[model samples]
Target: MSLFSTPFDPARDTALVTGAGNGIGRAIAQALVGEGVRTVFADISAERVSAAIGASKRPELAVPWVGDLAELDACDALLATADAALGGITHFVHSASPPRREADHALAVDRRIWQQMHAVNLDAGFHLARELAKRLIAAKRPGSFLFLTSLHAGTPRNLPHYSTAKAAMAMLVKELAKTFGRHDIRVNALVPGAIAAGGVRRGSRAGAAHSARASRRGQ
Candidate 1:
């Protein structure tokens, strides 16, 4: 057996996946279910949330909730809902991001974009992880946190809001990793490239909007 054969058993663990409505978030939530881990699928869309649970393939251990995670209250609400549904959340996967269309670059991008991006991408992500870490640390329980960051974090795409939030998230991961490492809690960021996942779909209005926005940003 490998030295790191298993950090935790899926059957005994629970996971929370935000933005689980579609795309990469959907993919990850589905995979977690396949691993036999109890999962709570949360999104801002009620229809999508219901759809995710109904189509879970295995609803025995999966739950769904419509949540606006950008709202600070929703963060606590989600954790409470998950804890009630699955006893306790041992794993957290923050895949939810306030839609990052190819709009509002450094010049045209207003504070609106920055506020929304920072709220969901960095503030909520870090707060959730830190809050969970505090609980686990006090209880002397081991846990893991996985954040979805972008490769564009360090690189400049002119989307100051997005890039800045991603950078902060990276630092959040690093800080959490160092602070919680001693408590047996693992914190890591999944820096993804231009994968066809996320919220935007190709050839759709949203897709076109994103492209138009990006084009306006001078590619």
Candidate 2:
């Protein structure tokens, strides 16, 4: 056996992946199930949740959980449901974020839009990761957390809200990683390039919008 083999034994671990109904989150959940890890596909849309499960290589290991992570209550509900259904969650991936509307520019973006973005991308991440870490510490079990950030985080995208939220999440990743290392809990961020995922479908308006922004920024 390779000395570098991952300690993540899917057979004994359970994962909760947000935004799993589609896109990057969906892909991650599918991979986890393929590794024999039981996973919870949490999304805002029930239909999307069903679709994700249907597409999984091991649907039996995938549980559907519909909730709006942007809302604190929904986050609480998700934790309770996962506990009741899976007994415990040893892995977590926060990839749930509102769609990047082309209209949401620096000035055009309203307070509600900013709040929603932060609620899902920033606040929800902190709450969920912190709570899970607490549980793991109390139980003396190792766990892992992965947050999906954006390239726009370090650079300016003219979309202040999205970039700011992602930037904050990036820092949050470090903070969690440092604080939880002593407990054998891992925390990291996955910054992806433009992938043809559910959030920004190929040739979709959002993709075009993003491209336009990049072009303007001389990216």
Candidate 3:
């Protein structure tokens, strides 16, 4: 057997990963390319997308797409562009999210911030997944979708916008999975904990100090 193996078929699979310009999304996109999968690295920053594709194990297999997913128009554009670049996306990973600001706690966050959070995390995600699933179903092909949620979905992170969006996404996953399973489209969510990566913000002085201590301990 091959030392490294994946359920994916390099010859048949094409992937689209949102927020692939940094952090977990970046890592997942690179890993897919490493496995010989043609992957679209979608992010809001052109610079980050370029850097991510350059850093991929198979740069040639990585397609760069930059757009703000918070806007419905942009989300539609992303789907069109990805479809043009790669005929059908066999694997989808939604990891795009607005960067969390420490000051945007429940009491201090403005309406714009709250709406943007939901726009990117939940609205865009649902739209993309549903559109992709429709394509897969119409073509009679199987596809897989992965949503990056958070442990804060169940517990409070003091960032109500972020937590509530994630909580809704967790439910969205279940709903989509139940509906799509019969169509050979699998939907799932990945809940991650604190990691020293992009998108992670220290909410308070204590949290910052604790993160520093954890870093020092290599935790």
List the RMSD of every prediction in angstroms.
4.8, 4.4, 2.3
Quick one: ranking by TM-score, best first? 3, 2, 1
Give one clash count per candidate, in the order shown: 0, 0, 0
Best by TM-score: 3
Candidate 1 ranges beyond 4 A from true positions: 1-11, 198-219
Check candidate 3 and list the clashing pairs: none
lDDT value for candidate 3?
Answer: 0.91
Per residue, candidate 2 scores C-alpha lDDT tens digits across 1-219 of 322257457656999999998778998898888777889999999998999889888899988999888889999999998888888899999999887765678879899989999999999999999988898999999998999999988998777888999999999999999999999999999998665553532256777777667657655
Off by over 4 Å in 3: 1-4, 202-219
- Taken over the whole model, the C-alpha lDDT of each candidate is 0.79, 0.87, 0.91
lDDT score for candidate 1 against the true structure: 0.79
**Candidate 2 vs. true structure, TM-score:** 0.88
Select the stronger candidate by TM-score from 1 and 2. Answer: 2
Candidate with the greatest lDDT versus the true structure: 3
Q: List TM-scores for all candidates, in order.
A: 0.84, 0.88, 0.92
Candidate 1, residues 107-216, lDDT tens digits: the string is 77787768988998888898888887887888788888999988888999677888899899999899989999999999989998765444433446878777667656
Scanning candidate 1 in windows of ten residues, the lowest lDDT window is 1-10
The regions of model 2 sitting more than 4 angstroms off are 1-8, 198-219
